[model samples]
Target: MYPQRDVRVRHARDLAFSLLTPEDAFELLAFEIAERAWFEQHIEARREQFYTPHGMSQHIIECLALNAQGRMSPLLIRHKGVIIGRANLHDIDQNSARVGYRLAENACGQGIAHKALNHLMKEARCIYGLDTLTATVSVDNKASQRVLEKAKFTVVDKLPTYSQVVDQRLGCVVYQCALREKVECP
Candidate 1:
């Protein structure tokens, strides 16, 4: 099981990262609504229900359940107490996890993603006992690629057709970060 306490990391005077809880449903829904178009530009289209409060609440519940199973850690990006984005360490295994993140349109180009990711990497290694992390970014998403690079993840592969995002099959770059000399999975 995961720790009950929230994971918090402060990057600057205004930007912070915190573990998202079920109570954050409304705020997260608001952020998702506001940034829907912006996020869709980079990733796959979200289900229509995901924009609703009920759907968001259900999603939060699922995230919490995953955390309980030691399979995921979903976090919110907050700027001056306002929810602005989300980051997740998902598909967790014994010694590794996959990372994904998204920022509000207004929060872009402010170094928030890079800082948040760097902090999450530390927490994943030290607190969660994960020894390696991986992330996949669309080739066209230079911003996200840069964020992964800034967090010291090395490019490991390139897929000409990685996955479908909306109607297109997007090419992607796979990145990995090794956190420790050895990983022991219980």
Candidate 2:
């Protein structure tokens, strides 16, 4: 289950990350469509239907369902009362999860991503009890690689053809971070 409270803090700027709710569907949809080109530069394009109101609403339903099943956490990032991005914990298991995030083109280069990631890291460890977090970034996306590195994630593997980005295969680097020290009983 997601924490009942939203997280707000002052780092480079005042930013809040909250659990995705059904009410956020349209606004988040607008943000997604507006940044489609920029997003596609680093990640795969979504199906055409996903750009529609009903389709985006359905996507949120699926995300919330997984969250209810304790399988994932999908979050929305807001700045100044505007939806600016998203951060997600995918493939969550007992002690680990894969992290991913995206920012609006206007939200780039302001340390927002780094701070947002660090906040998500805390949520992963403290709220979800995950001890390890991993992220896969395209080798060509230096900005994202740097953000992960600055968040203390280390590169663990490199896949030559990991994912699709705008119809092309993209090579990716997998990075991992230990959220907490795992102790063993003697």
Best-performing candidate as measured by TM-score = 2
lDDT of 2: 0.84
* TM-score on alpha carbons, each prediction: 0.87, 0.89
lDDT of 1 by residue, 47-128 (tens): 9998787899889999999999989989888877887778899999889999998887766777788877877787788778
**Model 2 segments more than 4 A misplaced:** 1-11, 181-186
TM-score for model 2? Answer: 0.89
lDDT of 1: 0.81
lDDT per residue as tens, model 2, 1-186: 111222232445768889999999878788888887888888988999998899999999999999998888999988877777899988999999999999887778778888778877887888888999999999999999999887778999999988988778989999999987522222
Lowest lDDT sum, 10 consecutive residues, model 2, at: 1-10
Q: What is the TM-score of candidate 1?
A: 0.87
Cα deviation of 181 in candidate 1 (Å)?
6.8
* Model 1, runs deviating above 4 Å: 1-12, 181-186
Q: Where does candidate 1 have its weakest 10-residue lDDT segment?
A: 1-10
